[model samples]
Target: MKFAIISVTEQGHKLAKNLLEYLENDPSVIKVDVYHKNVNSTLNKCFEEYDCWVGIMASGIMVRSVCPLIKTKFTDPAVLVIGENGKHVISLLSGHMGGANHFAVKLAGMIGAVPVITTATDLAGKMGLDTLAYQYWLELDHRISIKNINQNIAAGGKVDLYLPTKFDFLKNHPIVNTSYKIDIWNKTFIQASFSGDEIVLTPRRMVAGVGSKKGVTEEQVFFALRSALQHLHLPLSRLDAIATADIKEDEEGIKLAAIKSDLPLMIKSLEEIRNFQHPDCTTSQLVKREFGVGGVSEPAALIEAGDNSRLILKKTAYNGVTVAVAVAI
Candidate 1:
């Protein structure tokens, strides 16, 4: 995981620097960038660049900068604030719902600091749907549904699992309606709904692709993907991965578009593309010439494995730009 460490004071700067060194040596942390000036502004930039933030400053400024992001629904990153003196580490934002509490405890253990966990639901040792959503990167489309599910679980009902792997952590979880069998590959939303209290365990549906003509604007790509998903009756939250050719790897417009969508853009190499095979494929020559790659691996994967096979959304925007949406088959 990548983390941005922001600090504005001398003590904060030293602490941030130490934390950076510690995190750099930790395998769990892929990258850690330390900024010792302009805490709020730097934090905003970090929020744009990184998945999470670690603030080695007072709670007041941390709260001030984070409140607006959460209030505006502006893709807030997981936030953890630590005192300069190393007295306390608090998961102030996101908490259990956003994985902040879990991160805080891990970081605190690494730094020998006290983790100040304050989420009531977690303290009570009950199942937290929001936390589960964060773990799987699922967008909680219906908070009422979660509330109702949790209520049922709390009332001694069982919750079912549709995931491929068994989650032993959830075996004795206090808030599961019941445990039922669900095959991740073959189950439909309607079928899963009828299989007793159920939550689908497939990958998220926020992933999208943008095959653009030369010099296409980011807004155009975004609009095309959104329109395509809407046309297919698919929510953006179900996406799990975005795919494109290696040529678009450094395209700022394409990269930012994926980030804005909360989707990881996987740039496939030519060899990887050549490995794909599909009988009904239609874009062979176009994929090779435009993408500078051999096959449409992403579209093929989406088609063969997508949940809503009957509702594939494919569209070409301005010029030769194209976008495709499919659930895991």
Candidate 2:
């Protein structure tokens, strides 16, 4: 996360310096840059370059600087305006969905300033859907749905945060008892509803291992992976990465599929694949002859699924492309 500090006056500069000291000490390791806007400097440039903006100038200046650039809740960076004397920390724009409100509260506590969060959900003690999504590292399927939900909640509408799986942390959370209701589906293949401001969040908890013929096309590889995920009732949103054996690391088709999927490709060595244990994996005589292993996909998936990993789906092959899935326990 990057925080850019904008100060116009001498007092604002001093306050920026003081806040910088506290921000630099933050254990979160966020990148922070202070910009004392000069005659040639552009506030518009800061909007695109930084994840959050801290303004010590007037709120009017901050609003005018950010007004034309505001696109959506997901795209805009968090904006905060602190008084020159450090007495007040106000969340200026993109408060809930963009995390400005959370940052405001944190900066307020650190600098002994009162935080002013005008978002209705925050004031009503109802957890914002976007805030919950941010906390869990879940990507928003659509920001408009979140905005609609917040608008309804502001008008005394009740929203439900449904967890398809029974997460222990959520069952005991204090927010469950608040205005937002928590429901655990505890089932696979839970369809998310975009209507009624209902948002769906997936943990992105699975890794897929792939192995393909040397000359296979990237299209074929993608199709095979898509078929395999469908069989498992999983979406690409639940995948963390695509794992492959080291020998296939430089394979063009595999590389292209990983690039197209926008997922990290993790390669495991022969020794690692050999050491992994997956009972239900397919026995490939050709793979055994090449790498002296029963299978590549299952073992690689097991290794990349991380510690205490277990295979959730055995190898499935189609059109010379093979895929297996594993889940972190």
Candidate 3:
């Protein structure tokens, strides 16, 4: 994952540099972009390009600068703020559920800073609702679901435990309320009151369709991908994988989108699409000739039939550039 660290002080710069080095050596962190002192000026440029942001400055400034971006809700990248002296590192937003809290704790340990983890369930060493949702690949409609679940759990209310199979954690946890006869597929958990020990179980699957123009940079591609997902009312994390034509092999945007999304880009060749025998399909000769590959045909062939899908967004021009989405069914 890519990261951007902003620090103003000389000491902060040194610390940021050291952190960059540490992240560079770690396999999980693919890149670290350090921006010291002039964070406000560079914020816009760096915001959409990275997976996480670490600000070594006053908490107030961190909050202010990040607030606008947060309001936009483009993507939930882990945002953290560390003290200038490395005394503390706090996850301001997108904590464990977004994988930010976990990243903060790891960074704190490496730098010998105090990880001021404030998430109640995490501090209590109990299962966090958001974390649980992440583990099960479930997407909550709102952040209030997490708050409500945590509040109920803290108050000692029993929560329903719904899983495909019984696990040792569920067996041992005191708050787990389980029923062997319950079938999760047919039951909806929307109106179920939280007893603090119960959790609804459900399967998850999503696809992210990415479109790119020739010479499209990674940053541009990311913006398009984010806009497309937002238009479709889908979260980036929910995307299971990306589908595109084989010709995008050299497209930087396509490559980076796959990496940042942590989803494999399944590229289909022309022959593969030609062999697909779907009667409702429409072939695009212009697209084939232009891209030297069939963009729509490949994505359609790769997706399962009868699955409801929509075209979330058409190509939106940005500074004379265009991008589009091709969601599948």
Which one wins on TM-score?
2
Q: Distance from true position, residue 278, model 2, in Å?
A: 34
TM-score of each: 0.53, 0.59, 0.54
Lowest lDDT 10-residue stretch of candidate 1: 186-195
- List, residue by residue over 1-329, the lDDT tens digit for candidate 2: 46788898899999888878987765232357787865124666557777678899778888877788888777788989988889999998888667898889888998899999999888877776777665444556655676777665666666665665534346566653464555667653222343444455656357899988888889998898888877544456457789999988988888898898878999999888877775445578989998798888888887887876766567778899988887774
C-alpha positional error of residue 198 in candidate 2 after TM-score superposition, expressed in Å: 4.4
Q: Assess candidate 1 and give its lDDT.
A: 0.59
| lDDT by residue for model 3 (165-273), tens | 3122234443233212222322333222353334443334545444456787777766766665564344565455676556556777778867976777777564555
- How does residue 286 of candidate 1 score in lDDT? 68
Scored by CA lDDT, what does every candidate get?
Answer: 0.59, 0.74, 0.60
Error of 3 at 320 (Å): 46
lDDT tens digits by residue: candidate 1, 1-329: 56788887899889888888887765335457888778667755557566568888888988898765563222456788998998788988767445788789878987899999876555655555666655544444444455665454444444455543223323344443242232343342311232244444334444455566556667766666666555433445455666666665666666766777777787766555566544323355766776555444344334434444321344334344566544432
Give the range where candidate 3 is weakest over 10 consecutive residues by summed lDDT: 177-186
- Global Cα lDDT for candidate 2: 0.74
User: What clash count goes with each model?
Assistant: 20, 0, 12
Regions of model 3 farther than 4 Å from truth: 72-75, 166-329
